[model samples]
Target chain A: MTGPLGALRASAVLAIAALATLLQVSLAPHLAWRGVGPDLALLVVVAAGLAWGAHSGLLLGFGAGVVLDLVPPADHLVGRWALALMVVGYVAGRVRADLRPDRRPALGTIVATAAACSFVGTSVFALSGLVLGDATTGVGGLLGVILASVVWDVALAVLLVPVLLRALARLEPEHAR
Target chain B: MTVLDLRPRSPEPPERPGRPGPGGRDDARRPREGRRRPVRLPRPATGRGWGDDREPTPPRSLVVALVLAAASLMALDAAGALAPVRGAVAAVAGPAESAVSAVARPLTAAPDWVRSQGALRDDVARLRSENDALRGRLAAAPYASNRLREYDGLSRLTGRLGYAVVPAHVVGIGPAQSFADTVTLDAGSAAGLRPDLTVVNAQGLVGRVLSVTRSTATVLLVTDADSVVGGRVGTTMDVGTLRGRGEVGPHGLLDLELVDRDATPARDDAVVTWGSQGRGPYVAGVPIGRVTKVVSSVRETAQRAEIEPYVDFGALDLVGVVVPDGTRGDRGVIEADGTLVPGEAR
Candidate 1:
């Protein structure tokens, strides 16, 4: 019973991850504010890390990050996102043990995870900008991006994370048996 | 107890004195097999909570994070240093965008279909109303005979000037932001257009061709900051420099600076091209506009007058590109031959 349930959980997680990638690429552009769009991939990485342990979280983050690097508007060096997401996933996984099993704790975990992911992602972009000799990456624009991403991510967390967490909990084998 | 005794107990095998029997060997193997060795994994304790009560992390949080990151990256790259990455992403995203567009096409058509039905009925009523208004205006227009006379003078001048007129369409308007106060024309090299060709409408001189491509050309309107035209005030033969002061809505104002400091410019004086020694792009005696104001100052070298152009540039649908007669060279030979005395040829 345990073995079969574990396999089902893994497959379910993978499917959700794939779906998240698809949505990030296809739907995120339309929601841009002043030409700034939200980052769905970062949200997915943070969630994966919180759900699974550190090792699985790192693997998931790396895989999704690679797919994103391959997808549109190839502007940056390919491995930049991979490295950034790996760190984010690892951090989220480490924090999982500290979170309580109640509803409020789950919400708090998601909010915190989103904030951290946003900060890391923005910093990576800023560093890449500096490395590439782009003069427009001023302090003001960087701040604006960070603020916008955090607000957008937090809103998404509040609205969508609860429903997703409930669905995942339902899929657990112990509950099913 | 009596029933148990009646059951014959097979004689127990005599215990071996020194060496173990086959049954002892089987008994020895059973304990080893039953006590299975635990697999020596690197982190054995980590697997203990495999079926624990911890909930799976919400996918939405990760999705939100990814979206935020992607958007930030795109914005940064768009305004910052990741131009090459932006291009590559745009290339890969193109097909996905097209697919989405294809799916959304039908959804977008519904609004247009509804709007078209409403517009068709309104258009028919508008046409009927416009026809009635135009008929009334036509009847009233004949009463303004003096204005018609002025138009007749312009038509007669065009006919007698022998200027090769190539009709062109206006493909663009001014305030292009890049080339302020300039317009793009549909006619270009393919239409026999060349740089410095004089462009005009029925009213008067418009501007000159600045640049030309195979299918299009940019016209530097007389009202552009960079444009300077050699113009004269009416029959006074007062020469001046006509400079553009950008555009003011539909009408562009020209600053006419008198060549002679003492030359007095009267309001409503007709401004015409003061042709140079075959160097002026526009022909001599073509009307430009009317003087609106005279600006004279103590420190200024020459008095300046503001001229309101005769052409309604905003409504200009068709224009004439003046191809000077002598430009073709063959016309000059034909003219010289036509002027020869018949008896002197022998």
Candidate 2:
């Protein structure tokens, strides 16, 4: 599915995804509010999806999700996040596809997509865990995760997405870009 | 036809005033009736093809295949079929994580280090002079009785309580992802650290070992909402069940529900762990916390109170895990005199 140039881009995307996951898992607690931190890995996947399109998004999200699943203290079914993040990537890609970047308000689009991703990703995870009888969070806890995550991601996207888009654009072949 | 084509076309017709621009705004001209009106123009075509420059959506089959793959992996992991795979991954990731934590720890403590640098130097200079004076005193005192007395007291205490203890350092804390109250210890199964081993620090009980890997083990903090420890009041010796209240504010608090209905534990009463059945999970006589507030009950049989834990869950560094020896026979309960005794005799 990937050519030589495409593979390079994918590798770069994957590296960023892994670093984001590590930061989220390790350092984010120090900056948490009420026991919730922004999901940096989710932001990276969403950005990749929007900038590179659905295929790139799906692949990045899946790989990042798998890495998160394998990380210690995960203590849940592997690939649970993989499934949720994949959906987030696809939806973000579709939104980007519908409204060409040149025609849309850049910051508004990024914020909206990030907010949607956080909400959808968290809801899917909580609901699936509940169905599988593995989740301990109640409705209030689920709500807190969604609310806190969306607020944090949107704030971060305003600064992060534009920079990420520039980097991603450099990775794309000149002709394709 | 050639003569007509050779003739120059009449000068291009002059454009009318007030013609609108490409942006749909027009030049304004005064009407004959004295009212000004702006004329609007139709938009010119850019000639770019719609959706031609855009990347096409990925094939539906690709998405479905990926989803199926993810679902299958999830199912396998949930069924515990992927334990070996998970373990292999952890074995690699755990050490890398620990190394990262080791580097990050200093950075986090940078402020404290900076603050103490000046004081530390002064203290070192002062201690050097004091050491010289102390050496003189030591030389003059041929028989130092303080050291011998201290060792005698230590030996007596250890002899009274037969506890196999292994000291370990706290390596890392709960990640931000789950916000769980847990700590990773440097020692694991290699050091005889099995799951359910009781861990404590200098102050009081820390928590129990939840899981152990080859090189590290994760301890579940007593401050975790899921943790429950059997506790007793210091003065009244009233037994109660102690539970973590999660992070209520700056730190975590414990709630105690006394088993004895008539026992009213007062403020400042020390709480200690009621011994585990076989010295598993928790050991007897470990200080848990001090009572801050006592809530009286009229309708209910049990009394409740809030406990401020002795150990600071936020700043744990070094800890000790009590490893039990099976030969100790049946574990004893804490007597009113604060001594361990056979439960039957009590």
Candidate 3:
């Protein structure tokens, strides 16, 4: 459903996504809090959704999630993150679709969306684990990871998303400042 | 438009403080739902501004299709169809990962330095890794004695278990890969590693081999959320399931659940692996951890104990993979005093 993004814009987006995955694998792991780290890739997907539209969001989220699943040190199933982030992307894109074209979103809105979407992404990942009968932790364990992820993602989103949004906005010729 | 969407949007045009929309009077009182809002606001634009109706609501079919795709991926991954693609990240993670860590170490160290304990913990992590690096260098050294010390330490360790062991270094940590807590090891199928091998350190049980590639294997640490090892109570010899707490805090511990509800687990009781059928995943008599807290549920009549593993998973450096073969030439002999004497010769 996506219009063909210009080759330059597509390459830029791919580079950013690769950079996000690189940081997620290397730098982010060192910054883990309580066994969960901030999800830079999820934030990138959220930005892609908001900057473009729902279709763009879905495709990017799905693609980025697959990269995360394939990357080393990820022992969980391959499709779990892909599924969770795709939902996040769609929702974030819907938020973009809902806003009046003239009115830009507040910083509060973006971070709030990130926090809400972080919860969704984490819960979906955990629920999939449960459905597969592979959920190792009980409810209490799930809650800790959920809480930790929300805190970290929210913290990073406030800093990362705005910069990412600007970069993504440059890709869209018609998008206003 | 998605009928499933329930997010509420602000219907009011509150942003244009000076210039109101030309359709302001008509745009009011409209229900602003996320996916179903099809109203077009009459706004004067220089051929660029998108109307509200122009906003694309992703087709529900697309969302459904993507979700189904994700589920299928999970199923395929669960069936072990994605094993070849699993450790591809580690293969590409050589100098790039190391450079990122080295460059960011100061930035990561800054916040922790302000707090004394965090700094100390960082110091320990750094030193532990440095120790691992030194050991790696020592093993690569041309001198035979340098190899002997590592072999001596590992041989003494394997002597206690009476198993041939392959020593490996922890190459990387994985908090970035979602929920599972794991470490990438330098050893893989090349080191004679297969899935379900018992992994241990100088202190106690670390975890088991989850998956392996040609040169690198991922070890699912015992502290992961779903790791289960059969543990024997040190005092009573009652066998119970040792679960990785998964909730690692300043005080992380495993949960031990005995099969017999009547089995009483007391604090300070030692717990050891109860072994496996044919000794595949876990061997018999490896020190797992010590019970420090016992919590009993009166309603369910279930009792479980908390064990503090002897090894600090946070600072893992070196570990041994216990090969189940007992007939190996380098097997350690158990003395009458239960002291393991390292086997002699190459």
Q: Would you list the C-alpha lDDT of every candidate in the order shown?
A: 0.64, 0.72, 0.75
lDDT of 1 by residue, B248-332 (tens): 5677799999999999899999999876666357667668999999999999999999999998777665566665543331111
Q: State the RMSD for candidate 1.
A: 23.4
Backbone clashes under 3 angstroms, per model? 33, 0, 0
Model 2 agreement with the true structure over B1-346: per-residue lDDT tens digits? 2112223432323345657534443322333232222222211234111111134466678788888988898889978888998898789778766676666777645655876898899899999999999998988464345334323332333334445455567889876466568889987776667899888765678899999986688998988888999998878888999998766332789999999888888999999989777876788888899999999868877889999998878767666666654212122322222234432221
Model 3, position B236: C-alpha lDDT score: 95
Go through the candidates in order and give each one's DockQ. 0.06, 0.13, 0.22
In order of appearance, the predictions have TM-scores of 0.38, 0.44, 0.46
Ranking by lDDT: 3, 2, 1
Candidate 1 vs. true structure, TM-score? 0.38
- Cα deviation at B57, candidate 1, in Å, is 15
Task: Write down the lDDT that model 1 would get.
Answer: 0.64
The reply for model 2, stretches above 4 Å from the true place, is A3-5, A101-105, A175-177, B1-55, B102-346
Ranked by lDDT, the better of candidates 1 and 3 is 3
Cα distance off (Å), candidate 3, residue A65: 0.7
Who wins the TM-score comparison? 3
